[model samples]
Target: MGDPTPTNPQDETSTQPGASPAGWWGKLRDRANQLRSARRLSRWFNVDDDKVAEILAEVRQQLPTTEALLVGKPQAGKSSIVRGLTGVSADIVGQGFRPHTQHTQRYAYPSEDLPLLIFTDTVGLGDLAQATDAIITELVDDLSSSSSKGRILILTVKINDFATDSLRQIAVRLRQQFPTVPCLLAVTCSHEVYPPSQAN
Candidate 1:
């Protein structure tokens, strides 16, 4: 070998006289430094308090101050519907619901500063001997207290169990209680029920 091929200085394995070669520990240290630098840069870019506040204020102003009461039986997909509408995770939904009464709970989206939509979830009716009466009473009282004109009632009914007497009675009672409030019937678990054509 004419001149012992010259080693590239930029090579990580290159070692000078009396200097140790950069091993796995050196590579790990370099990656750690890169991560630290990246974190610092991220923090620098993400720390605009005034801008964040302005954006939040604008969003709050644009959001509609509407409330929707979700009434359904147990496991009627009330929380699932709320999560779908609000794009919040199941964990957040579970944590956000504030118990209003023994049979009712309320969840406000963006549970922090300003909430856009307020959802009131009622406990399952017709489960116990007096559950139906208790739920209706609680709901009626809550609705009577709310002066917000934008309030609406959402009824979640399982598609397969739509013809149940209990569900029909609950619907009739709620309609009577809040005649003016628009009632939206959300049929849940449609996949389990066959199509009309399939019914003999």
Candidate 2:
């Protein structure tokens, strides 16, 4: 009988431990695809619908997502905060926000497909023409009530706009519903409160 030989650890032909040759090749192909993916959607990297969906599916599997719910009236600096957080131009922020819920619009930082942070802004809040209850209910439903790390609330109120009865009600109800999710108060439009003599 011929003597048995040991597999060489440094052999270039060796497959990974417990992995078949086909499986090892598949893993290599997947890694190559991920490496080729554009970090952001831009002139340098334009992602098609299929590519975006694929990237998003992979990202959801790999990352721990955190949702930031921005509850505020119209023009209450929600977009401003998103701009600051994302460092995207106003044009991109304006275009990026898409319908999340009936009364909420969401923007994912970096790129929608590869987002680490997500911001959901209430669109119909404080508008006389729209019913705020539906919005509140929708926001409540959107809460990731299980994990405190999964979500947080951002309540924005214009500094000079004291008609906060609605905003206050929303904040109180959301806090009660999801006591675990911490709420942050952002008083916007402070420039209106400050005199011209005051430095920024």
Candidate 3:
């Protein structure tokens, strides 16, 4: 006897990996329709939807402001880390970063108009060309002022350029100046570093 014909050929294709119940083009069309419906609904409701607007306003009002200070040397991926955490574009972060002091800059999430979180970035430390002491002093002052407002210090160090003495000094100084604020040490470019056993 000849093999039985499949009752649902479409179902067979849909069962494959990366295949969707709706075909590729079909999914795009569905998404377009959904967007159109959302636009229509938005036009109907406008900002006059008191319930939604009130809820959003209340949520924003209740959100507490927090600060994160990113301390690291050049090319330590500090901005990259900030982008990952806040889901903000690189260009936005680049443009939004405003000088807070000679050696520090600040970027407010959601912009300064409506900020729920603040990220502070310091000038690269341990570089021969820059005045490390002055930069450290600026950083200390910055942290001391903001420590009362729930601040977290993130220390990013490149795996390839791990300068123990400089990092140790920074940590010790921060501990003495801002004991209440918590510090996090992050090792960037870990993938590029060879494992101990793999090293010759």
Candidate 4:
């Protein structure tokens, strides 16, 4: 006891405690597991397998129906969404205002047995005088004559500076024209401007 031995018990790594060590097979198994994880991560560069699986699930759940109209202003992306939903690339619709829809464009969903949904693109409200009147007239005539069930009208508009008289006036007229029918108003270009619900 010439010099007191300083025993630092806190230094656990410095002391060789009697513990069982992992064998060679255990180390090799851990390395293989790490390599497998790295390979799985690397495979995601070309395509996302998770997203593909999700889309396929969505396609399976989607039910096809044939009673609706896509009504919106010009260049409001109605055509784009219609094409996407229907899974068709061809010209399902023509651009300009046609006097009469002799052949109302029908966009078909997958599954041959499913009924094809017809999308009638009406002219922009601003493009014609009393557009609400024209639209209601067409819708009434079509529904009355067709063998199909009642249709749903989906109205799309760009959300921005809606204080103008055009939208307010149109809304009033539409309410008057089809008081009993159901209407769905969809606001597009929402990324570019605030939605009406958030507006002050």
* Candidate-wise lDDT, in order: 0.79, 0.82, 0.80, 0.58
Question: Could you report the Cα RMSD, in angstroms, for every candidate shown?
Answer: 10.0, 15.8, 16.6, 14.8
What TM-score against the true fold does each predicted structure earn? 0.61, 0.68, 0.62, 0.45
**Model 4: per-residue lDDT, tens digit, 63-138?**
4445666666667767766766666654633332234553233443443234446566655554555455565566
> How are the candidates ranked when ordered by TM-score, highest leading?
2, 3, 1, 4
**Candidate 3 lDDT score relative to the true structure:** 0.80
lDDT, candidate 4, equals 0.58
Q: After superposition, how far is residue 137 of candidate 3 from its true place, in Å?
A: 1.5
List clash counts for every candidate, in order: 0, 0, 0, 0
Residue 50, candidate 1: C-alpha displacement in angstroms: 20
Error of 1 at 67 (Å): 1.2
Candidates 3 and 4 compared by TM-score, better number: 3
The true-versus-predicted C-alpha distance at residue 135 of model 2, in Å, is 0.8
- In model 2, the runs with Cα more than 4 Å from the true position are 1-56, 144-149
Model 4 spans with C-alpha error above 4 angstroms: 1-65, 90-115, 128-131, 161-181, 194-200
Regions of model 1 farther than 4 Å from truth: 1-63, 194-200
Please provide, for model 1 over 1-200, each residue's C-alpha lDDT reduced to its tens digit, 9 standing for 90 to 100. Answer: 58898767766445543245556567778889999999999988785889989998887777677888988887888988999999999999999999878988889887747887899888657576556777778878877884543788888888877545666676798788779889998988876677677853
Candidate 3 lDDT by residue in tens digits, 16-88:
7448745676778888999999999999867666877788767666668788888888678898898898999
Residue 7 of model 4: what lDDT? Answer: 75
